[model samples]
Target: MELALPTEILEDSRNKGVVTALYDALSRRDAEAIQQILAPDLEWWFHGPPSHQFLMHLLTGSNKDSSSPEFSFVPHSIAAFGPTVLAEGFDPARSIAWVHAWTVTDGIITQVREYFNTSLTVTRFSAAAGQSDCSIATLHCPSVWESSLPGRVGKSVPGLVLAI
Candidate 1:
C-alpha cells in the first residue's frame, strides 16, 4: 500500500496563526515547543557535510553559547514545502540561523538542517539594533526534489520514476 501524505493547510488565517505561535515559542527560547514540531528520528543535514543531529543540537538550546548573556533569536519565515518546511532568520545580535527541515510524523520535527552564515548573522543583528546597514539572507530550498526520487534507502534516484 502506498503511504498517504498528511498535511492540512489551514485557512490562511489559521496557517499564519500557527506560524505566529511557532515564532513566539522561538522568541522565548522554548526548546520544548521547538522540539514538539520535529520528527524524532530526524536526520538533519547541512549544505556543508555536518550531520543534521549536530546542527539540531546547536539550534535546540544545547550550546555553550546558548547560555551566553547576549543571545537572541527572531524567526522571520516559516512555510510548508510538501511534507517539509523551511525557516530562515537570525538573532538580530548574533551569528546563528538555519535553513530547511522535515516533519516526519505527528507534527514532530525530524531533521533540522541549518546553515549558519556568521556574516549574515552579524549584519542582521546590527540592522535590528539600528546600528548597521546589512541585508539579511533569506532561506530558500533548491529544486532537488522535482528532479529526484527518494528510494527506501534514502538515496536520490536521479530522474523521476516512470509509471511503467
Candidate 2:
C-alpha cells in the first residue's frame, strides 16, 4: 500500500519549495519570477553592513552597472516552522554568511528578514503555562536555533551554520 506523508510534513515541503524557488529566481535575476513569488506589499528587514546589502540591490534593480560583489544565497539547509521558512548560507571565499527569514503565506512570501556577516539565531516563543498573555509572560523563550558568527576564519563549516 502507498503511504502518504503527514499534513505538516507536506506543508513544510511545499513551503520549502516556495522559498527554494525564490532563491533560484534570485540567482537567475528573474524579476518576473521574483515578483510572482513575493507579495505586493512585502515587508523586508535587513541587518548588517550597508555595503553587504546585495539583496536590497537585487530587489530594487539597483547596482546594475556597477561590478559589485555577488552574494548568492544557496541555502545548504532549509527548515520550516509553520509559515516561516529559514534559509542559511555562507561563502568562505568571500567571508560572508547570510540568513534569510521568509514568511510564506498561501504560497507567497509576504515578508523577509535578512541578516549578514555578524550572527543569527531563531527562537520560538510560546506562552508559559497558565500565562494567558505572552506580552506579560516575562519568562524565557525557548531557543529553536542558535548560531555562531559567520566569517570566522578560512572556509565556513560544512552544512548549515547557526550562530547566536
Q: Candidate 2 clash total?
A: 5
Write the residue-wise lDDT of candidate 2 on 61-87 in tens digits.
687777866667788778887788988
Deviating ranges (above 4 Å) for candidate 2: 1-5, 129-140, 148-164
The estimated TM-scores of all candidates read: 0.43, 0.79
Model 2 lDDT vs. the true structure?
0.78
After superposing all C-alphas onto the true structure, candidate 2 shows an RMSD in angstroms of: 4.7
TM-score (C-alpha) between model 2 and the true structure: 0.79
Per-residue lDDT over 1-164 for candidate 1, one digit per residue giving the tens place of the 0 to 100 score:
89654445533334444445555776676778866654456675555334223334545546655434634445566655434554555443433344433343344445544454311111012234443555555322233322111121443222221110
lDDT of 1 at 100: 37
At residue 148, candidate 2 shows an lDDT of 53
